[model samples]
Target: MLKVPDHQVAGHQAGHGHPGPLIDDSGRFYKPLQDDDRGAIEAAFYTSFSSNTRVPDHIRRFFPVFYGTKLLASDGSGQWPHLVLEDVVSGLSHPSVMDVKIGSRTWYPEASEDYIQRCFMKDRKTSSLDLGFRISGLQLYESEESGLWKPDRKLVQHLSADEVRVVLKKFVSSNSPIDPNLNPDCSFASSVYGGSSGILAQLLELKSWFEDQTIYHLNSCSVLMVYDKKKELKGESSDAKVKLIDFAHVTEGNGIIDHNFVGGTLLFDKVHLRYSYQS
Candidate 1:
């Protein structure tokens, strides 16, 4: 049976008479197809990307493994098509997840004027313009029995750079109740974001690919960072994973470098650097 994912930290939710992403027992994620060009665009990107032999094997690991599409019945909404994807957090007992939307600009060059204006306004209003990335949502695992510490989406999206750093610290901290004022010890920083297999290293690998590849330009895409808090507390090695998600705004590169994505990724490197030093 397909059910709402408890681990989802961002994007639309199952409310307001609209269905959201669903996951099945087979460790597959089902994302509802949007009722616009975005759905077709995303589908095309995945279909092409999966078969394209040009993408390096190492870089391909950064994205969610695509499994094509499925028609699923919704709650009084009849049958709807959903993109089937690998559930990145499938095995984690207490997963901590964050969604960081990259790029200073989200609209494509060929986007409508109204769309460009909307994205521009939002980019300025949020930290995306200055930081080149913005935290869309996050849920830190407090405990198996205590559930997760999920803040309001609006509060997270509007956070300043300083506040974002605090949140990043909190995500790696071992503290309970998630106190904002408590100085984070960053017990999991080195393990989760520093090791050879850590998020930083994986992102750098992705950045390297973006530096040369001109196949596609990903706009408004997010890097989803996930780790198991239960494992960290148990003194296990970090099982951190970084995967790119959200391809609704992807466009053909037209043989030009995706400077926007490259710049945002570079800024992300700086953010990690600051986080490491400050902690």
Candidate 2:
């Protein structure tokens, strides 16, 4: 049976008579196709990406495993097409997830003037213009008893650089929630974001690929980070995962370097550096 995903930590929600993401019992994620060209564009990108042999296997691992599309019964009588993807957080007891939208500029050169203007305004209003990324949404699991700590999406999107740092620290910390006074020790930083097999390393691998490949320019895409908070609390080894998602705005590179995507990856490197220094 398809149902609302309880493990969803971010993105458009299913409510108020609107259809959103759904998941099946087989650990497959179902993202409802948008009503605009974005749906077709995203479907094309994934279809092409999956078949492209030029993309290295290691880098391809960073993207959600696509299983094509399916027409599923909607909330109403109509059937909707949903992109079937692997549920990145499947099997986690308590997942802590964050969706960080990368890029200083989200709109592509081919976008309409009005669309560009809207994206420009949004980028300036958020930290994306200055910081090269913005936290679209996040949810940290406190415990089985306390449940998840999810802040308002609007507030998270508008956070300053300093505030972002605090939130990043809090995500790795097993202490009290987002309180600065009761600062956490960030015990999971080394395991989750550092080390040879950590998120930083994975992102660096992606950056290396983006530094060369010119096949696609991913605009307004987010890097989804996930980890099992319950395992961290139990002193188990970190199992952090990172995946690139949301390809509605992807465009062909036409042999030109994707400076915007590269810049976003570099910004993530900067974030890791600062986080390391502070921790």
Candidate 3:
């Protein structure tokens, strides 16, 4: 467990030293997730994929390796917001951190603040995917023939998770889920070729529930991937785990469920954008 001051705490003047980035793109946290709120997050990582299945550690990012909070003694300054967070993926050699955030730019940031909170705050009614506005992507599937993952050169592409999810949802909703229109980057294609469908099925579930969220990322959110070299060398079935980040622009209730705001399916077809695998 690492104690970090929230990103908002920067330049506020403090007695403690700044624990800078563990790796590049590492952000600080001045606010804690509260002791009571910790359980849900942990569960989100460990047991939250599907209500019925817990993904194996080799391929799953169910929570950080270490997660918890510690109260710091006040130094007569301001309310110290040092937060406890899991080392989301900075422990590996030359590891890759890929942020996979869900939602659209227009709807996420454009939504009013009141609506954003009400919609994003997950109660028992919301699925875990919608709660965090994130989903695991099909990052692992690449091609030697016409695809992205070559023996060299890692990739970090930009595309909306909203576009990916909605397009996939519409595709799977039809009689033929794996049709020609489906993007090769869609996890469905890989699931058909490989097995461990439990993961793909869970992702499909994420797509099905995409409409439930009223808010989404306006500026953009990231779905990050972390690499495990030792695991791969040992021939662990999986080598990476993915998680989401950058909630600065996340909004709530921008698009009502009835409207399916921003016409995601329509946008998906228009964009027709999916990139290659990373290193």
RMSD of each: 1.5, 1.5, 12.7
Candidate 3: where are CA atoms >4 Å away?
A: 1-80, 90-94, 100-203, 213-219, 254-279
Greater TM-score among 2 and 3 belongs to 2
Report clashes for each candidate as comma-separated counts.
0, 0, 23
Worst 10 residues of 3 by lDDT: 148-157
TM-score per candidate, chains pooled: 0.95, 0.95, 0.38
Q: Write the per-residue lDDT of candidate 2 for residues 180-276, one digit (tens) a residue.
A: 5897678788888877877888899999999999999999999998988789888987588899999999999999888898887797787653464
Error of 3 at 182 (Å): 28
| Residue pairs clashing, model 2 | none
Please provide, for model 1 over 1-279, each residue's C-alpha lDDT reduced to its tens digit, 9 standing for 90 to 100. 878888888987666656689998989999988878988989999999999999999998888899999999899667888999999888775699999999988887788899999999988888888888889999998877788989899989988877777777777878764655667778888888776888788888999899999999999999999999888999997589999999999999989888888887886676753475345
Task: List model 3 lDDT by residue over 92-184, tens digit each.
Answer: 433322233343222343557874565455211222233233332322212223222212111112223444444333221212223456543
Candidate 1 residue runs with Cα over 4 Å from true position: none
**lDDT at position 28, candidate 2:** 89
